[model samples]
Target: MPRAVVRQRDARHPALPRRAPTPPWTRWAAPVLLAVTVVVQVATPRTLDLSFLLAAVPPLAALAYGPAATALLGGTVLLLLELPHYDLGHPGESDTATVAFVAALSVLFAAVRSRRDAQLVSVRTVAEAAQFAVLPPLPEHVGPVRCAGLYRAAQRGTLVGGDLFDVRRGPRGVRALVGDVQGHGLAAVGTVAALIGAFREAALDQRDLVGVAARLDRRLVIDAEDAGIAETEMAESAGDTGAAGTAGTAGAAGGAGHGEPAELFATAVLLEFAADADELRVVSCGHPPPLLLRGGTVTELAVSPGAPLGLGLAGVAPPEQTAVGLRPGDWILTVTDGVTEARDASGAFYPLTARLAALTEVRQRDPAALADAIWKDLVRFSGGVRDDVALLVFAWER
Candidate 1:
């Protein structure tokens, strides 16, 4: 495989953006402010009255330093305020006492914030690990093309969701997928994993995207059948073991409507960049057509849709595969319906093509920048998305 995978983080992903570091001088901000206060206090008329300013040093220190350092700085401030010569005015006892109290409070605040920050970091670390493990990052470069992907779960506080996309190098070529499982949240994670696994396995030896799609359909159908069998057996076992009164309740409950499992299905777009072929072979399984970005214009690829996976449609007949010619600077952008179907506050659907066209030609080439631009525009348009969004962007490396 002639591709190199790049993750969200600078090829860096998963890790949320952290606060930028403060300048080195900021480390000594509290001490420097204290020194300045002293200089102003002594160099000027003794009546300039800067005692309030002196009290601010320790609290400022707490913003940057830990509890112990904040406490030490607070102590220095208290000493300066109380020391006879340092006290330009015959300072009141209350002024010195207040400064000491504030310093102690700053130390306490520092300790609490420090503890919370550590906890947040640990939790975020675990979440990112799980997300990366379940759905590894897409390839940064597929052959001479640069690839980038982004996924945002509709389920609050979760990194992974029902939507999925992946790009992997294989014997057939570099096959990429953008798919959406039926529902959102962790409940759909198992199906997402199974489909991804099937895609990856098929990509290793399958000659084309059609075969990959067929395999995915089979995997979902098989899983759904197994789940149905388990539920049926459990219902029967409960009916046999329970008292007659309880059995009737269970039978009535099952009869009322819970017996039938919803059909499992997923819409997907699969792409195969065959070896030495300067084009993309695309197969759409009830998925929206991918948009082509070339020469600063966006055009939806004209690919015929077939039945979604899990309906066993592929077994009867393979989905139509369209081969798109690739230009040296052409970019292919595909996404789950979570993006295309997203509606704004007025109930207007998101204008994906219009938004893509709005981006400056230069910004459209960088996958990360493109993702950010679209995402910001999306948020601005919809207030916020309410569904899992999976996006993929890859351009012939320029």
Candidate 2:
């Protein structure tokens, strides 16, 4: 998943990461180096004989320029070597030939570097496309409310993680879902995608937040069962194979017993904004209590806890929405355990409530700034986050 991403305000695009451009310092260094070499060779005494410095120009050019440009720089250095080796004085024959050989090698090195760079760019493009398809960038706005989202994976080099959040505007109102699947990493991605798919569909078709939660619950249960059947078929098809024996041993390791149903549950919170009133309907399903920031005070809403989705809880005790009144400037904050449970060297959990109350800047800032400040502070407090962190902020911006 992405190490840390903070997105807000007016970016409707897919957030496609563009090709990294050459650094400005590197681009200008080649020519500046050539000019400085000539000037120093002239300004210094004849005994100094700065022919050796010319060799550096080719390799420096290779850092920012293509093979053709690198060769051109190398050729210029060779011309200087031929013209008495330096404007100041003549260097020894061995030194002159050494500089020439180094320049030639630099040109070839530039060609190899450029080719590998192109290959890297191509691979990056495909990887990003696949990751973003699983969890695309969040929108800037959802009807009257402005939106801000932050996601960070515990593992490096991943654009999407197990934690997922999305805001959608539908016939009911602006609805949002913040969820964290049972586990982290690529292993939980399929579950994340399935949940998001169900949430998006339910957010539009379902008349209320409860219905949306029900939809997600059913999705999790169905997907889990299908996965079990597939696994069974695979295990049976490979009967007596070494791979099957290894799999059975691994599954039975530590007396965990073949995949418990609890592994399928996900803690989530569903919210729906009232189009006509200054209120929000929230249903917490084993998710952390959301924070309500009003003026200068931060209040963690006392939401009734319900069983997590995917454990067949809809029949026993379905999650119900709790109405919370909102003011013009109030901000709602929600996050995964990655943030609240982040620990310090002493193994203390992050004091999110205390920090939110103390950080005066959070109140005056917009939704984007508020989310960024929280994330930055979280990182600073934990020294380094070791789990997937997902945060979402919402404010009535009308």
As a whole number from 0 to 100, the lDDT of residue 69 in candidate 1 is 93
Q: Tell me model 2's lDDT, rounded to 2 decimals.
A: 0.79
Model 1 Cα lDDT, one tens digit per residue, 1-398 = 11212354432333242332335675788889989888988888876888788788878887778899999889887777778876655668888888888998999988887787677767766666777677886666877668877778887656678998888887857788899999998889989989988988998878878888989999999888777766766786697689998888876765555445547989999987766878889999999999998886899999989889998974566798899988787888898888888888789999999988889664644776787677777778888888888888887653
TM-score list, all predictions? 0.69, 0.77
81: Cα error in model 1, Å? 20
Error of model 2, residue 127, in angstroms: 4.2
Error of 1 at 72 (Å): 13
lDDT by residue for model 2 (1-398), tens:
22234563212223333444457698788778778878888788877766677778888888877899999988887777677545635766787688778878888988988887788778867877777777777777778888888887776766667898988886667999999998898788888999999998998899888888889999998888777666655554454355766766644541342332334879999888788788888999999989998888889998888889998875778876799988887788999999999998899999998998887675586777777788888878888898888999898764
Q: What is the lDDT of residue 211 in candidate 1?
A: 83
Error of 2 at 323 (Å): 2.9
TM-score of 1: 0.69
Worst lDDT 10-window in candidate 2: 8-17
